[model samples]
Target: MSPKNYEIIEHSRGWNGYFKLDVYRLRHDTFEGGKSAILDREVLERGHAVAVLPYDPVRDEVVLIEQFRPGAISVQKTYPDMPLWLNEIVAGIIEDGEKPQDVAHRETLEESGCTIIGDLEYISRYYVTPGCSSETVTLYYGRVDSTNIGGIHGVVDEGEDIRVYKVSAEECFAMLQNGQLCNATATIAVQWLMLNRDRIRKETSALRP
Candidate 1:
């Protein structure tokens, strides 16, 4: 038998615009087989997104981009010397009717001018901020050619001013170790690559004729 564990008391809109904020009043079953008291929670509705770290196994390098994040303004006040511009992996929200893999390829070229070379290696799928935001991200490690992956690239209408560049895998990992990388997706992807780089390099090398 299955238990109906949750009940929604009320669902309402807190704010709706470029992004949505919703309010939920609900109650759910507790661990001791009891119903929890009614709770009020505000959730930011960001939906789904995709992020990809571009790696050039042949050159032992990675493609990264720096862009100014409007949300970082408040963060810089609390964190000492926090730069307004953050280095991050290529990412974008998944549009309606669009596939995650398609968004990975599209954003990679639009943001970094780097085209993926092979199938993307799936890394993880996670909620970015489970406590407050309804945003989940699908992450990947994409193979690319880093030979010409340097310049400023982004859609002009989107107000993006991105500076793209390539760095040796060693340098990228060192940035991770030194607390220089702050973007969540970048942080996760880099840590994952650190563990899997050896196998990834071997596989890529095997493909070389």
Candidate 2:
């Protein structure tokens, strides 16, 4: 791909604690010709996060977390008669000096109260939103025991109140089909599980002779 001509003029933290504004000067290279442009862009530098889809091949279940999001409150007011909370995979931002896999493992424990055993399979990495934000996320798949999970778990200091659920793979798939699962990260993680369910089940079932 050809490189686009763009220069960052200035960047600084915005009034909001979550984002920064970036001023840029650009020379657009359209198919027909080139055009000079100057524009300001807001970039969210929340940094990278990790999302883990914990699946139990033995029981054919998937672990999910349900939580109330302040971001969803505005949309809930639009309906005025429905709940705005969401069900999503265990996710957390990468802490300083923390690896992505470590973040996934730590979040799974803190959010779901389940230990992730065995290797973590990488799914994909992509920008959550590129239009005006710079948040990138890494997705992964791993195995967890559903039998030992119970009760709600979350970091109180961060004001997170999360409920953990262990639902069958079939049920999770149904939720995805019926539009119940709406978040992009959860959708991608669940779909990845569905695509690899059979193979993962078979491989995980067979042990070394």
Candidate 3:
């Protein structure tokens, strides 16, 4: 049994800001009949994004941004009757011609009001929701100093109302355990940090020579 090959015959734009129609001819081989079959499929044009999990080893805190999510509102009636807002890590869509690392740094500052001063550690890149959406997100980890972070931050033009919270790693873990934090990105990042907690602490503690 060999892999199937697809050939695109035609494509067109869709209503949701992506390619809608795609005519594909697939080639496959059958062992029993020794025959070939053709199939068709369509794909959507998706965009890329970036997410940053900013950690402050000195304070043992991770920065989280809180904002109201419309999607949450639409689905809140299913369970946990409450507001549709959420607390998540600093993240944003990668603008055209912007590097992923740069976008991570930019979104960190925009959402957390703190500057990242350490090396940007690449974590993992993943599809946000593969079932219906075509959005890929690159994740990164960076050390930041939250010593003087106190103020409202977020893009005004984009109608972003973000509140920054500097909570200890222990508290973040507690939130995860208590069901207070349910965002996927935040959960993934925090779990990663939990796994590498010792190494991150040691690396951040080593003095520059």
Candidate number with greatest lDDT: 1
Best-fitting candidate, scored by TM-score: 1
Cα deviation of 147, candidate 3, in Å: 1.2
Please give me the total number of clashing residue pairs in predicted model 3.
0
- Flag the better candidate by lDDT, 2 or 3: 2
Off by over 4 Å in 1: 1-4
Model 1 whole-model lDDT (C-alpha atoms):
0.93
- Cα error, residue 177 of model 2, in Å, equals 0.9
Query: Which stretches of model 2 miss by more than 4 angstroms?
Result: 16-28, 31-33, 77-83
- Of models 1 and 2, which has the larger lDDT? 1
Residue 134 Cα positional deviation in candidate 1, in Å, after optimal superposition: 0.7
Candidate order (lDDT):
1, 2, 3
lDDT of 2 at 60: 90
Q: Which pairs clash in model 1?
A: none
RMSD of 3: 3.5
Which tens-of-lDDT digit does each residue in 7-124 have in candidate 1? 9899999999989999999998877788999999999999899999999988999899999988989987898588788989899999999999999999999999999997998999
Q: Tens-digit lDDT track for model 2 on 1-209?
A: 55465555565666455544554444455555564466666666777899999899888999998999877888777866545778899999998899999999999999999899799999999998898767888999989989877678999998889999888999999999987887999999999988999999899789525
